[model samples]
Target chain A: MLVEKSAAELSELLSGGEVSAVEIAREYLDRIESINPSINAYITVDGERALEEAAESDGRRAKGEALSAFDGVPVAIKDNICTKGLRTTCGSLALGDFVPSYDATAYRKLREQGFVTLGKTNMDEFAMGSTTETSHFGVTRNPHNTDRVPGGSSGGSAAAVSALLAPLALGSDTGGSIRQPASFCGVVGIKPTYGRVSRFGLVSFASSLDQIGVFGRSVDDTALMLGAISGGDSADSTSIERPVDFAPGGLDGEVRGMVIGLPGEYFHGVAPCVKDAVMKVAGELEKRGAKIEPISLKYTEYAIPIFYLIATAEASSNLARYDGIAYGYRPSGAESLSELYLRARSESFGKEVKRRIILGTYALSSGYYDAYYLKALKGRTLVIDDFNKAFDKVDCILSPVATGTAFAIGEKVNDPLAMYISDLLTISANLAAIPGMSVPIGLDEAGLPIGLQIMAGHFEEKKILNCAKAIESFVEPLRPPL
Target chain B: MSTMDEKQILRVARLARLDLSEQEMSEYARQLNDILAYVRKIEEMETANVRPTDHIVDLHNVFREDRVQSSPGAEALRAIAPRFEDGHVVVPIIIEGQE
Candidate 1:
């Protein structure tokens, strides 16, 4: 029953004087305090700050002033996004004590919209792992089954929302980080078209593919938060100048003539249960009068390799700044500069991060650059071409968000190959820079949630949202485990 | 590809700035070689005609004006450093063969 209420509904109650913002914040904070102990979803909680913000929201409501949808909504931010004066550790010991002096563009935008900060959620160390076990802090357990993992590196954010710790949360998707976790956690997660949301404040993981996304219990809530926080900012040159659309009126199920493409490549290697769930949802949409057809993304298998090459190369270059100097953990008793850097990074970064860093450095290093990095870049063009060809045939592509339901925490940890394979379905969208969302369809036999992913061409978020809205109407809204 | 020699392992370790102990070097060489062998499967897939992509989206020149903006100033910079000495971050000598 606690998970049934949407963020908008709670905001309405607070605005109508039916309940105070303080009460709403308290309810969520208490839930998080109790549930998060088991999940390790949040690394830090600003309980006092949240209470103060809620009281202030109540004070404003008392004057009969209208408030934004997010005015009093308690939301969690991924620790990777810089929040002024808060510990912005990207789940790495390298940034253990680092507090940013300025806020990231996304964080500043959220604060400007009157969103109450619940706290900073956890993530993989430097956003490198499929499971959050790579976090320097600790593993973020799945909300449904504590023994299992909530897919990551955005696992903490997804788990927080799934556990009802926060009604909505922010996550960054690079090669399916957001959508995969959302699929695992059974929540609605939206990774807007690349450049749909600015990346000004998010700590760099892979600059080109990194995007700030939102996780909500429902489609409308996700759209509402996304619309408020998205738009061009001067601070981020990559931020696009797109018009904001928050109206939920047109999102009702009315897809009488929309073209839906079911990419054949996405079904390869997908588990039977997950495939059945996706096809069942597609069938429901077909009955509703939408056109669904099988389409081909010829170069789909190349996505993972291309993603690793490009992401690692860029990550290696970006992470070069964390050389035990400016703003992060530094080792003690290093008599030399090289020793300072080697010792600091070796001790601070988790194994996964170090692995990728080494891989990336090798890829971009002299002699290997042409064979690895350049070759991957060319393969990337073909991947984009695949999406371009598919989109020309249909307005959007419907696929499974991940290959399967949530797996146990240690299931894929030792086998990095198995872990990388989880991103098989979702990585293509990031490579294409298209808008994609993971909508919870149903739970598997193990009581784990499965998500059906919908992807649209670049800057065509409206089409993606409309299709997701139609699906949301037919399927029951997913409830959090708590 | 399944194994690397001790000399090759040491060379790569130095390149990665990892001063591995003699025992650790051999172990890492074995591990890295195994991982590389696994990843090299991509080389088998024919990509002769495919052009590589640098970015997923057609986003280009996402540039901000080259206007010089003021930072948090020296105080904030000093606050972030692990060891600051008179506006400069103190670190051990890096130049080789000089100290």
Candidate 2:
């Protein structure tokens, strides 16, 4: 029943006096109270604060003072984003008790727009894993199937939105963190062009690749939320200063003259069912007056190896700041400085975190830097070049977000290599620093969701959104599992 | 292929500030070698004349105005510390006379 209402629909209902903000918040809170215990989607819920904000929003509306369209709309934020006075744990025990003193630029912008904060959602520890299973706080289960993991890092945000606990949620994607989870949970998630949204509040996973994205039930709703949160902020050095137009007017399903590319390499290793669903979407777009062409991104095969080296190198450098000296948990009974760091990190970080740190340190180590780190950086350039070439021929690239549907919770966790490959189709976008989104297309035989990823050139989010909206209109929004 | 040895694992662990037990060191060496072997596949690709990309976007020198800005003061910094004394976070002494 909740599948019928979009964020805009719910907002209109609240504004038109059909329902009050307090009642809306209560309904979602009630839903969370009923469903969250099973999915583990939300790590923290601010019921009291949310209701207080709702009451205030209701008062404003009563006096004929209207806020933004999203005003009084309930939303969830990923735990990695800093919210002043809230526990902004990146789902790691290290930052479990760390409370941010200042709001991340994105949080401030959302709050200023009058959106009610529901609470922080869970994620992979330090936003390091492809599956939410790496979260220090237990794994977030998929709303579709309890046995499978909601895809990760932003898995909690996607699952929460999918389960209707929140109308919209924020997630950060460094390498498929947002899109992969969106695919798994059967929702729409967009990883904006890097620098499109400010990264001030998001804990750094891989600086160049990390971008704050949003999860919503529909493309238009996702666009509305993205529009509100997208502009540049000086607080984050990497935030873009370009103008952004996220109006839902473009959702009219018109893609005339738009060239959508099907990269031959992206489809090479994909599962048959997944490839069938994605190609069906491409075929649908072609039917809607869009030109679909086969394009070659020759360097596509090198995406995963290049991604790990660069991301791990950046992660190693960025995570070095989490020493026990500053905030984050510090282990007791340390006899020496070395022991202090060793114990704190060992106890605080999960296996994936340690694995990445080791890999990064080794890559960036003096002797191997040229062979591994530097070469990977060059390979990254080739990947970007490949995208640039494709864009010259087409406005956007369409592919499956992942090679396959969501796997069971423990399916790939023990096999790190297999888990790493889960990000195959998505890593190139991050590597090339372009905008990419995962829009749910159809469910597999097991009833698991499969997402069709659409990517665009840097700062060309409008074009990507146009193409995505065109596809989304054809394949109706998926209904959530009860 | 560059094979990782115990000494190399200890050296890397030390640089990474990870104090791995003897058992963990051997285990990590095995896992790390497997991972590196996978990464080694990139060596076969011909990237002879490719340029290295440090960042995806061509942004350079994104400098802000040089002016003093307000940040969370020492109080906030102190709040983060597990223990503090004399306006400093207290940590175990590893290097003698450093504190």
Candidate 3:
């Protein structure tokens, strides 16, 4: 059951001298060899490299030169986040052969602390879809229910952690890619405040909304991974120079006199089970010396539009670098530069990606710029103003991560609007540039996992993390029957 | 507002450098129109006085001292390229084209 241990627990075992890092890596690799085929959690498993890294970690430990607390723990990276010398396909055939020559700042920081990487996990094509179905590699199944999607575009990372393939995994959230999947998989996931983490090596899906986050079975483990990967990077200009210490002792799990806002807007269309689960947790928090109050964010409905406009516009521009001549797959038999670019991009990108790119291009094109993109930008300010005003009355806001639990894999794939609506509750935080985290509350009637989302103002991760920790302490960890 | 039509879709696709088949173009036209219809709701909101929020964080010029740092050289960079010649990336010839 070494694979079943949390990152924090694995770190403890390694520091206690009870197990070597190589053995831990080997155990997870063996589990991946057995389980990965069924769930499709990982797109690539670099067992040899992971073992080598684990051996080095063991060497460091024996020499008493322990780098960081989570050293020796194996973690999976979402395919979109680049890992040096490793194939970092963002789940599209276009970049299927694209091996990065540099590590993402988040992964680099983790490697510097001696964490072994267990290869890249699958994702929606370029992180564009809410369901992992858009991935050219294939969809990642939910560990709870094989027929259900694990939720995306970080489905593989969430599934890997849910199935105990890795105790900790790195995911990037653009329009709820991380939190939605974490909710679906019944794991803890965090999307730090905008500019909280560096995005230097992350393949841009939506540059403004994209953020690298961590997935773990527990909040403490997620916090440890967050702490390890956070800090400003010169490579990323938007990265904020903020102090981050997500260590266990950093938070005291206190909720006394804390005001938790229950946003009425987020509950309007949510499933009864999901709303009940969150309300149940809200009741628990109220009893534990926290005040729960009903709050309204009237502009909540505009988040999806704002997010789509901004995310797609950014994506269209960002993905322009994937021309045929660049470092990725190229279609042969192109006689002209225009033909080459067109064929390469069209053939490489998936349906969802193509749709977004076209939408974005049109939104930014002549005659539509002011009506669509610019209008969303102006509305974005109102959304941010809503959050700023709400924060003045509350410490953190509680909501459901998604409308419900994981749906059948192919259920919403063809219905693009339904897939887009999956991120409705979670997109507001991204639009407002605030920190958000999803903690598992419990399950519904069908036995699918449900997550309660906690949101805090800009750079107020400590508040949300503390609230998440309080919820973590109150609820029992729900393990999927993988 | 006008729904997305085939002509508009083709124009955007050309701008985006995506070569779509007739079948794919029609499919995208429908999907894009559906999405635009949903996103069009934002136009109803009044925001004449609100400032456009571009970057989430209020960060201005962040300067770093100019210093040479080790990087993956040109050879390494070219290694991942689909078509690479002697220290340069090979590509198709560029020309003005008639549609």
Candidate 4:
């Protein structure tokens, strides 16, 4: 029961002394011990360090020196975010032994409030894939079905939170890494507006599109975690200063007289089950005094290709740093540095990673620059322009996070394009640099969870979270049959 | 229609500093060609004069005082290196005749 409570409920108990931080942490750790074996959600579960941190938090509370409401809550972090003295593999053998010397600004900010990290969750190698299957550690299964994949690069974080292994989790979204997995896992996940959260220590997959975000069972808890970790840091030039209080008015579900847009492109060719679930939620919102109207975002079809081209291009450049010299897995007995670089990367990098690097290298290559990379960049401008126009009229856009629910493992793994298309509805947010979130709406014919996506314009965290809270109120929260 | 043959995949792999086996070469070539065919869909959208967005933040040329900020020290930095010497990383020679 302690493990099932949300971070908000746990915080209240912590304040009331009904529970000690250590007991709550230990309960979750015990659950992780039992459940994580079947799910494979975490690559590293640091129980000793977590218990020690929880004890320190308890000590702070006894002395009346508690920093924030989330002081003693246990949380899981995606492996890509750098944790000092903790291994940050980014789900690749390339950095299997790499330990960060510095803490990511977001992680440091969480520590400011005494959040205990349960472990480093697994992910797609370098956040390249849509399913957690690409992780060198192992695939993270959907908590609802053992045969299904928890959607990824942030799949492990989402799965851990969904299975009650932790109250909350942090994830990075480079083209739907956080929101899609959050959908697949039947939890709430958010990708804040670009430059909203500092990316100083979060490992970069695609510099322009990557943003750090949070996952929770409820909207307010996710917003609270987002508020604590958000703010401008000089270390990350892209980070923009914004008001950190994201849960403005406590997500009171006040959508009266609000206009919600349902982009036609998102629902046009989607599966009946996914469309019905999203429309049912939208219809409920409309009945509650919000107006739902049709809107067209013509560039929606281009998101997958543009995202693939731009993201892989940035990834190729970002991952070039793992050359065996400055900390990463290096091979033995190399005759020259070229051989060393080749061997280190060739030996350690996964198939997806190499594919991305080659795609990126090719896109940015001399003859293809104007055609692939530059064309995607220009096409991205249209995508942004499309969202900019729509946000002027609608408070937020409602859509399905993916075309369908979580698919069986290995269903789309070998086919890279199919997996890339899994993120069509979500990738536009990253391209447009807008805030987007996924909250559980209902389920498909199969017993799996389906998530409804909410999107708002640039730096509109309050709008999106408020909308998510509204949806959260309408839908009866569904839990995985554990 | 867009495709990368084996020679092109190998060339790009070399540029990416990755050495591929014979199996990998053919595999990457096919996969890359398939992805490229999909990528070619972007060419369908014409943006003759549209400016490409490299970074979404509108702030250009953010300037701060050029102060020497403290960094994670040399010891901490060297600790994660696969092979290191006296305050230096050991790497195979990159230049000719250096070995």
lDDT of 1 by residue, A380-456 (tens): 77778778888888988999998889889789876666677678888888878888999999999998999999999
Q: Candidate 2, residues A1-482: lDDT per residue as tens digits? A: 43247889987887788878788888888888999999999888889988998898888888878577667888999999999878888999989888888898888888887888888898988988888998888999999999999999899999999998899999999999999999999999999998889999789989989999899998888988888888777787678877766578756657887889998988987889999998888888888788999999988777888889889899988988877877898998888977888888877877788878888998999899989998998888888878888899998899999888888889988778878877889999999889999999999999999999999998887887888788887886687886
Error of 4 at A438 (Å): 0.2
iRMSD per model? 2.4, 1.5, 1.2, 1.3
> Between 2 and 4, whose DockQ is larger?
4
CAPRI verdict (incorrect, acceptable, medium, high) for model 1: medium
Kindly give the stretch of ten consecutive residues in candidate 4 chain A with the minimal lDDT sum: A244-253
Q: In terms of TM-score, how similar is model 4 to the real structure?
A: 0.98
A1-482: candidate 3 lDDT, tens digit per residue? 89878888888999999999999999999999999999999999999999999999999999999898778999999999999989988999999998988899999999999999998999999999887989989889999999999999899999999999988999999778899999999999999988989999999878888899999988888988898889999999999888875577898888989999999999988999999999999999999999998999999998898889888998899999988786898998989888888889988988888889999998899998998889999999999999999999999999999999899978999888878877899999888888899999999999999999999988889889899999999897796577
The DockQ-based CAPRI class assigned to model 4 is medium
Instruction: By lDDT, rank the candidates, best first.
Output: 3, 4, 2, 1
Clashing pairs in 4: none
The C-alpha local distance difference test score for the whole of candidate 2 amounts to: 0.86
lDDT of 1 at A426: 85
lDDT string for model 4 (A218-321, tens) is 89889889998898889999999987656634667778888999999998778899899898888888898898989999998888899999999999999999
Query: Candidate 2 chain A — worst ten consecutive residues by lDDT sum?
Result: A1-10
